[model samples]
Target: MELRTRVVLQLAMATGAAASTLQMRWTTDAGACSSNGGQCNSLGPDGPWQAVMVTAGLENADSNSAAEVVDMPMWPAVGSISGVLTTSSGGEYNPFMSVSANKTGVRHDAFGPWLANLFINMTDEGPGYQEILRFKTSTDNSDELNATIVAAETWDIRMPTGAKYEAPAGFLGLGPSTAEDNKSIPPGLLDQLKAAGTITSNSFGLHMGSVALGQKGSLILGGYEQNRALGDVGVFELVNEVTRAFIVDLTLSVETGSSPFNQTGSMWKGVEGSEYGPDVTKNIGGVSGSAAILPSAVTPYIYLPPGNCEAVAEQLPVTFRQDLGLYTWNTEDPAYARIVNSPAYMGFVLADRTAQNITIKIPFKLLNLTLESPLVAEPTPYFPCKSVDSAYGVWQLGRAFLQGAFLGFNFEKSVMYMAQAPGPDMDQGVTRTLEVDDEVILSNAADTFEKTWRSQWTVLGGDETGSGEGGAETPNGSAPPAVGNDGQNAPGNKIGEAESANGDGETEENLGQVQEQGSLSVGAIAGVVVGVVAVLGLVASGLLFWRRRRRQAAKEDVPEKEWEAESASGVHFPGLGIKYEMYAPRVTHEAPGVELRHEMDGTGIGRRSMRISQDMYANRI
Candidate 1:
């Protein structure tokens, strides 16, 4: 059956079925790892694959907690998925998110190819740690099921293909894995060099991302990656265009007719975290540290594996129509969002008019997302760093930056949000839509996007004068002076009265003074406090460990009374490395009611102070 025909039918049945019953234990260790496709050999001995392991299964998170086995191949591939989201006026809108994926869905008259989501079990077990990926899917033996792309649902059909042979026992629970196989391994070239030399570092980590299943089946979008040290993030404009074009094409196909979702693109950014300066960095949870952003010109590309695809990379199927939407940050500032001195509107200009001379989304529209995580930034020396107690509660809040912007994606939902941005020409502007074939976003929209970005900082970046000044330019090539409400001419081009204005070129007289102000933010201060606390706690915990190990080895006369009593109560902090023995207590204080300043020698568990001679065993911290 065709993918689309089956999707609609199965979607109806999907609502009535019970959640899958299954579970699997994800493990990591010194064992073999790989699955059927003869891919296991890579994880066997001396390989980077040994560091990560993954186990996924069909199970309900609400009920099952224990690992259970089930058939891995029973799940079938979805044929197609489709949907359309239009504005209240029935006008299609664009998605404002900064990232996108290749998509597939239903549109009989639609163009060349549609995107599809594929899945397969995978585990990367490098030297230090193992990682497991678990996801679920529903069973549907229909074609229209393909129209069900990712979104507006939770439960899904989990199916996996592409596996390495003879995977480790700990890697067993994986059911559905998504990724493409290289098929060929060059030689012992790289592996042999590492094995012959010493491996210097081992920083184990994980990647966090979001994925939505299509209303019917799913969509196949591609992903990308950069230098291994940093993962994948792409150009937002590029993906946005693809999505807009696809929506248009989809609508046309069902009505008039046009090309297919053949060649599409997407944008991405590495996970966000703490590393750079304020407003200069962003952080995504799960991934540690901050991801310094780069312009759209040269973003990375991810080739998806046939199975469960990596967020950085995705797999695209040629048979279905597909369009990849790119979402990204506006790298420009608002002061120059639009052009005020255009031949079109020469009269009085609007001050504080956010949108300047930005182009509208001719074929589509622009979009922006207001909700996002906190930006990453390192504390300046005076910034008073804080990591106080590990959980960093003070540093985290529900909202970070209020980045209200716009991008385009057609929708069926009635009411949707669009960011009102300032254009370069000082005119009101919305999101820019692009032609999928071209990577450039609409001119005015791009400028407006950049302008909004500048409002976040004091001055806009990449200002032409290099002085950080902002103003309108006449078509005849004359620069106009900025005016104040008093009708007096304001400083035309002077920027950053002193210091560089927050990476933007705008000049504020006391910028230097502001920079000199108290450098640390509340989050930084908290980090410092947390760091110190953790360090102290670790020291105390170590001391306790040393004392315990020594006592176990020496058979010192540890009064059973003191061990039991102290273990039960009396100042115990596991991480702080401090444990007080009822009998060997270092604390000397009089009991509340009795003036008994009873104190025990600093002796620990049956031994003298750790590493100290029997003579100098009195002090403890």
Candidate 2:
């Protein structure tokens, strides 16, 4: 059955429709612009181009919560801003701002001095209290790129009073304005900028820089950085406008010298030898029909069908942890170090709308990310792949995949563009501007940088000559320049550094060394009091349960089934059961002038209901 399904998918991809074109221009000779803050003149003659720095830092400069600040690296692409929230009662307070992952969910206070402002009744804007605030991207008073946006004044997660809320900081929502739930939502940052004629269209580009290289990323409004993307651009249409989903047919494969399995033959039954490598290569297979690219997801995972995820898991030394809903890497295994340090990569081939194929290769180093503190007892290496039930009819690629892929959205044209992004060391400061109605062409040339991992790094046990094992064959049988894990040249050969838009000759601080400190604020003191009260209540309840248990007979405890918590915005923990809510009739948030919809009639048979649920889930935002 699996073989038959694979054949059908291959046939469908071969006969797909022609790809779409985007209007844009690419240039590498323009003046360099500061990614931290300033006008990106490199974006060409486009007017009012703003560059927002993507840093792995705390959004609130005054936050002193040591336990939470350590998790900043997990949430990169945090755009920085300072803004004031004003209440209807003439109260005002400044709040820290960061990029929001929840497309339409409300922003809340996690750790900062903004807690007091969150409870104040702001001027109502329909479904919730909202206020308009002007924010500057940098501390520079002279920067004219400041933006005004509407923000939600309530918390998305309503925690019981006296319980320490683990909510995230204030967020800047960039979801599509055309979404059904967002119809009444005030215009987002992008929409407001377009309305004021600050930008030609409601379009943006993003490159979540490498966590391994400790590189800072860029979020460009109005255009993209041409240097970041390499090779040809794969254009995909927004299949579901409500979800802003970009779906594509994709295949996955991995190449490595050290095979995890003892068997020598290929694991995939009908996969062609030409499509993969020798016995060392593993064909991880592809999605049944299509997969969604969810760039805004809060978690960093690549959700795939159960069978496909297991296929990839078989190639690595990993074990699934039910508690965390993630695959924890076995660091004690020698193969773990060999696979991550050696020149191995898992490649993804996506079919564009034009029937053209573009491959994005992610090195093993990037896939070997770490989870620390609250997520786990200690820092643990983890594999980002998660299995989803086939019944849902939808799989997604999240932020982890974006580390090596550049995403560009053209809302006006209802088109999305993607390409392989270069590492920080390979950037050349090239940029492109996509103006309204301009014709943009994609290059058909080969990738400017090396795509094969073997061509860049040396394998540990490989031959010293670099020709036979763990190395790519070269004309002169010589090894390429070796690079350290930090993206710097090793002692043997030195590579030239490309000029960057930031113009900072120094390398960024490593993820482990990056830290921010601030004294406790009013919010922290209030949180301490709430925490003490909650602890006392828990202790008193525990004593009562202990006395009752002593009087009863001892009994074997049953193992609890694994479960995941779903948020109001529909973001679920990985590897959870299907959400039946997608099929149920539901009403929008209670507000003025919004009507309730009863779409599900409970009159269908079993199979018919299942089919309807799958269809509805696929279309859900």
Candidate 3:
């Protein structure tokens, strides 16, 4: 049957008002990590991902809890979770870098301290102490499951002895396996969780909160949070590509007042021989759809082609701060007051195959971001908006895109569900509708619909005895779980709360309810305390990273008079080591001109620190 038709039928067959959904409340480090005399001071506007504390060691080696789990602020992306290991001999191994099967161990050194930790203690078989890399994966305060790791190495750094290690176990790899530009095979973390019955379905949800608003993001493993979603959910097909990234096509535009700043051309182009990129290669306007990857982990920004970047800047009444490589609005200008008062009135737009085009309102308060690092003596508040040249072949829709929308990933269906997030300026009347194919409907009618629905759950290992009141009745009671505004448990023992618990063998009857730390086990309390302390360090380290970037920005800051003189020079970010050259190409039928290139490369369903050592990468982040 067609996918939409099946979905409609499932909605009908599933007779539950109470959703059997798993929900995790998103929190921020701003409470504890603020350096402005304990006041609110966040580096980015939004960067909420699932994190947890974990221990790592070899599979067979004796484990040691004292193996220093250093509080190096490490927040892996929700979409991509892996580890960077430094062997005892100063070797670095990154399993996520493995694109081909035969690539057992390659050394990659493009990462900055922003991505690396100071060190990790080992039990002789750990990343820093052992000759090879391996880690035992388990989160802090909990031991629901333990998994082994197959070691993978970087291309630039090799083992001291030049001896090869075993191939990587390869779990939770969002990228395509084999790196031959093909689709991913089964056996991902989602598949494993489903197979183990940790979750009922292969669907997951994400809600990244605005950092400025003191909101936290959430990651739901089995189902989505209905309350968190402000508007109607829009489902879109994933680009049929071999890579596992969430690739999609979107048209770009902006609105300052009436007469919108409608751009024409592609925002991002796909690689040749790949099912990504713009429809027409060159002289692209923002109006045309362009293929781009929505990156969940990084900071907010729309990485666009040089031509498009120039167009956006020209239209917006903002200044280009060379030192920060950001666009800035004059605080003294009247427009700035309007921007601050009605930030929602000034926003961006993205169009895709779906009828409802996505629009996100960026508040002026969020734009006033400060770049403070250990390298910088003080904080520099440059508007965070930036337009990068997409020459580096990395066409990305970063956090900026997500701020306006809520995205869900269905690994089972290989599709991404998107919907405009609720906002102050959103058009309340805007909506999208889809009608199931008539042929499928007629065919479905031919069969016993009720019997078919009953049998479907039966095949899914449901109890099939009864459907309950206040929700759909099912044999197994696997109805969709309801989400509360507080983001706590559903009505009853709804999710994996019955199964997962602390090492003490206690299950939380109130799955959505989180009590005070005093009520939790010693391990849970310790995890919370450790997280608070480490987050402070993370904020401190982030400031240091910003300082380092400031130094680089100072060295390359160019004036308008010197623009022609320095046009040929590339702007290099010290800490990140990425070199960007600004270039604007005229509209053309060929490929869009290039601007920024990425030199360095960088889930999920939780909030904790996970140890992968050098041997194993955490399967779930």
Candidate 4:
């Protein structure tokens, strides 16, 4: 059988342009920004950009719930701690008022005291809750030389009584705090951060990290990770003033052998030998309209137009579960393993109003997420493609799509920028602060797509010498590096870390390198060279090469049962423990009614009551 291929190449090649000559100049002295009660420079030679590390883990480490709680980025916050500890002589030793709550509420034993007064109310969507109190908060970025307190919305889940719990993960909201319909809402986190002079502008960027590779993602306020986004950046206007929705002419397609739904006579059709059987390699078509980028959504599903959802479902081994209102993956099918392990992907083409388009390729492995407990009776493999009626205005690209795409929003300018995100194995240290009016620069030399695909192909038993069919060769006439199934590079192919651009506009080498005898690797040196040559041209070839090498590499011959058991044992979905009601259509009818009057007294001032009764009488017309 002949299979077709739809390869979408990068729009622009990387150009050897000179790096930006601009240097970071701080107007104030060292440590002045943090010492003045969280007030710092906003518009100066040094931009007002602050970087926050977003790590992934469970909110309560001791909890036994299994809801696929994976790939959730917890933000940092500052908590107020009053009172002083008494010394042995009954004298106050060290007096402290507040503390930085960085990396708190992740484990069951380290609950932050600031969340004691916060109450969460769950919505119809599981895991997506609203805090009743608009608590005053500040980002715990003391290490970044800024810490400002402002009031914003915080989210968490209410646990059962007597259950041990920690402070829930902090979700930073970047949208407009007040909508036209609701003026009482508090300011968003970005706006609050700007007000406190913690950041330069009310803008932010997000890379949701890669679950397939177990990598931690980052949230940059007033800037973005230069190396995280590749190729051309598509800028779109925020169409919905309330939700910040944008218009994207989206098209979906898949590679050959990527999905079982593309097979002939798949389960999409109930009949045998039906004409609906088409070659699995055909284009799946497109859906054009507005799609909201919601990072706070509970599920990873990308809600799409109903017809487009059906088109994608036709190419995958998924069945529509009416109960869950989602398409569940058929883990029993042999093709399921092949699709995830193979070098196959689902391509998404997002075009702006200017007709500029960029294709985002999502590896099948990232889409192979599991749903447990409340979502399903047992651990079940599920697809993130969701179908919703277009009439309801429910088109949205949730965390599932954000995993492969980097989203940056500038509310002050009413613009949103999108670009293809680098894979988890790539280096992530190339961060550049953005000015209020600055635009995101797209790289012509960064081949993030080709590099990502080549790495995955090599891990799937392909030739490592770049002689395999349809593989892109590196500049050295060799494959990039062999990445294991667990998203770690093979030994000796590790990429080195690029020094972060610090104050005085000068780059700092490893500040605390304990190994004086060790030298930088070829890949690491190449990264620094590229960074100096072109600020945006830095490529993370093997920065985190052996980060996860300790994980047992998955073998092709591994039994399917064994893989299933391993996956089901620890995987969970964030915010799925709460109960929610699925939306369903309802019917209503109107009937004629008659009014009955009763009087208790004869006088006009006496009490009188009137009741309306519906007439059930029907006439044969």
Candidate 5:
């Protein structure tokens, strides 16, 4: 079998290049970026919210990129303090110097050989929840934070052993929650940061720039930028009525320029109870959704209801690529310009249930995206839009919608503030940190917001945009790490969750790892082989069963209304939990039956094999 490699095109924001310097390239190939693409800079001379070139995993203040630049989103987790602490002095916490794991396969590139010496030890305490702070190396001492905080909880952490390039750094999460047993575990990172005195306030500002416009957005820890906001900051109450995600009431409308849909309706508008065209007047809750989930870590895709999704597909001239499970535009079509460059806009409105509520408008530049992947040969333009099929519970407002607004979350106040984001050329902004002495912004914001609500939400218009899809430029194809329970926070953020090019089970994370020496006992080897075969067979049978079930449903002509009614009653959403492997090497046991050995194969890379049982002392409520 021939291994057909796909080109992971470097989209605009994903590369963090200046607009004039922007160009597509393979995900594994190195470009002419400085210091191997790590953001390196000092604290004093930097502009406000300026770009820093510090990559992940460097112990020293000033060090070049240790591994190729890849993007991975990571979060901080707080541990429970109610129980007596038991110290398991198994692995000493050093400065965490060097590249410990590269499970995502960037370790195979030109920089792979250099990664081994950078930092190669990862202490695997093994499954179940534990606190961990995976901080990246910064260029300076003062601005670079080094404080003792609770470790963030994670499931299935992939610490790939090989030097395969991944993000130089992971994202610092501001959310205060975690996913456990299909439910949200609270007191996330925000609580930890506050306890450690990392910030004076519980709020953090985010400005993920539009690479197409050469905008430089920055993450303001513990605060936000002043002048970069285009309007009054719209404060909203964070509701936990749905999933643990950030949810807001929103309506979606798409403008297809001078397309036929625009002939009768200027844009296809789907709101609660207003029928515009042939499409049914789905409620904004049905069209856009009741609780729109805003995830910063994953790529931006507008996951909508099936009715709204169909309305969008009908509005544009797109061919549905079944293999890729996405809609592609015909660039050669004369109507293409109307779809991509029309002065009109596609609007996503963030509004409240009341007649008078805060509204934030998202434009077309933020919606119509240009996507290219190693999975696809050329740059294919598509809307980062999808549907919940027949479901109607949680809608996701991804990176595309965020690009149009500056999002600030204050976990302390349980409120969210959003403002229209200013262009790069608009203003030089000042930074403000939340002080403990200061009053809660949400309280004051709510008092003021009561008088500001208008019956209708505003629609933002523009042509300036970001990349074709919802992701930040990361070295190892990782997305901007945000608070997520699912393992989809790594690279390939917006890419569909389908099989790879050869329809094989292998993916970017599972594809490559540098294997070193290892040996397994006869019993161990037999157990492993049997396990693999059993798993594969089970998976195949389960998939076949699912497909047959789906076929039967289609033949039965089940009314869409049935799912809608069921969804209205609330879907039993077991929190999304995907498994990812973390490969670790170099382990020695001082005692018998407490062995930590590397499971090695022909490739010589290593997988940590543990033969010890952990005593469960504390249980978090």
Candidate 6:
């Protein structure tokens, strides 16, 4: 038996120079100009006249894209600190750096995409959480991050049409409290270990000796109070007026750079909520959450393992382990992270924990967009264009990547000690580390991201290195990434539970990564097998029925006995509403697992047909 299936791809490809029903191809220019077939760049330096296109079945980023989180980059270090502490070993203290919290803005999402990019570019992925940052569990050290506050790409702020109402592009900014000064680090931790010791690792790019007390944690410089939706923080960056209204998607890597721990496992992608901030809750006591973060700035974290059994990881949403005297995940387990360092702070500290290997690589990438249409819904009349379906075949696209991520960290150098407050006012004590380097290559993140994805894509292609999706040059089936059901964040940052799809078991489409939260086990992958759908069979049946009817109408009826006794053995219809009901049961094998609905009208019709067929049976079984 021959079986047929229909797979819709990018719509941009359908209207292009190379249009194949199954293949969708779009250009960046088209993405910028049109909502349905393109993507956009949050960072500037983008040219005017750019165009990104989307082939048929391929939804445009403007149409399917969601606002994503990018890494925060430091514009420039305003000040620095150094101290000398004596150790019991009779050595000068290792040099740990610190900066005061004189943070500027905490609510900066109103600025357009350009300014938004600026803010994210300034921040880097910090140290791990206490929960998953263990030095060793059972076998070896592993670098795992417990994403305390689930970060998702959401577009909450909107453009204000008038006064009194906030702009729609508002950002949910939050930060940590305290000074960036480290007072008790053992003098020369890196110098002593490397100058004379038995260890292995490297220094870091961005440097802070301690994690909690000395690192930047969205805290404004010098203790100035910054208004945050939830915790302490200055807004991401400076945004322009136009940017306040436009929507853009940014994908963030959870733990950037390399690893300090030594483990051998992998990580996977999880679904993200598609909204900005969550529903406002008032008056809570038991089990209420603290230290909130902007959903839009959420990203994926890398996973690592521990060899020994003496270290632990911290899991703060906006703060890092370095701020609290803990090690980072990049120095020990790097996977192609670039080694960048500020001359003021030397990197690579595997041998002796001097400065860490500033190889903590964080990446932010932009995809398919056109100039005239940077966003899907914009300044003028909404273009009435033929659109793609709501479903974004992300799994089909995801099949081309490494499929997992790994995080790394150094446990020996970074340690944590919890403390209670003075007079029960409650002093939260955590000290960790985050390194800083002065290598500003905006494109580095994009390059590394593309490289990793390409590597996996190459493997997926089975040794054929043509270079598929998410690469420097356009990918093999280059089209826009998935967008939201409508290019907007989920209602109030709420995540909808998994439910059944359409008759074919499909949920709505075009939902960008923002709405992609859900656990998919590796075990589940082995269980799914391709199956034929009754819808297609019914389509064929309808066409055949139409042809037969047309032929019958065109010619006179044959002799009475000439018409073959109609097959009462099986009942099938190809007309209108009756089509699905008749063919569904005939083509389905997994009905037991499906939600069954009885159509009374259909039952009545069937009873009527059965009565008519009984008359025709006339003595035949």
| Highest TM-score against the true fold, candidate | 2
* Best candidate (score: lDDT): 2
Q: Is candidate 1 or candidate 5 better by TM-score?
A: 5
* lDDT of every predicted structure (CA atoms): 0.20, 0.40, 0.33, 0.39, 0.35, 0.18
- Candidates in order, TM-scores: namely 0.17, 0.49, 0.45, 0.45, 0.44, 0.17
lDDT of 6 at 138: 13
Candidate 1 global lDDT:
0.20
**lDDT of each residue in 1-621, candidate 3, tens digit only:** 445534643543352112323332222332221112231223321222222122232232235322322111122233322333333222223222222112223332322111211110011122211112111111111122222222323312111123223211111222212232523322334444455664555556554545545444545555554433443344444432111232333233222222212232333332342221332222222233433334343334555433444444443335554333345555443334333333222244444334445544444433444444331245544444444332222244445555444566554554555554543222212111111111100001112212212211112112211223444321112233333333334345445343234434242333224454346776775676576557567767989998887788678883545643443344432111122112222221212223121111110101122122111111210
Candidate 4 residue-wise lDDT, 45-65, digit = tens = 111112222211123443564
Instruction: Give the number of colliding residue pairs in candidate 3.
Output: 67
Question: RMSD in Å for candidate 3, one decimal?
Answer: 28.8
Residue 2, candidate 1: Cα error in Å is 30
What range of 10 consecutive residues in model 1 has the weakest lDDT sum?
246-255
Q: Candidate 5 on 1-621: residue-level lDDT in tens?
A: 112211222232343222111111111222212333422221100011112222223343346633322222221111211100012211112222323321211111111110111111211121112223322211111122222221111111112233221122122334554343533233444455465665555656665555444455545546666544554455555543111232224433333212222212322223322112112112222224233344342223455433454455554555555443345665554444543443334444444322223444454444556654333556567655543321112234545556556666655665556666653354534556654443233212222211221211122233211112353211112223322344334335443333222225453233232122235566765665576567677778999998898788879997767755654443432122222212111111111111111211111222221110001101110
TM-score ranking, best first: 2, 4, 3, 5, 6, 1
Error of 6 at 170 (Å): 33
Clashing pairs in 2: 18-354, 19-353, 19-354, 23-440, 24-440
The lDDT, on a scale of 0 to 1, for candidate 4 is 0.39
Candidate 6 error regions (>4 Å):
1-235, 238-456, 459-621
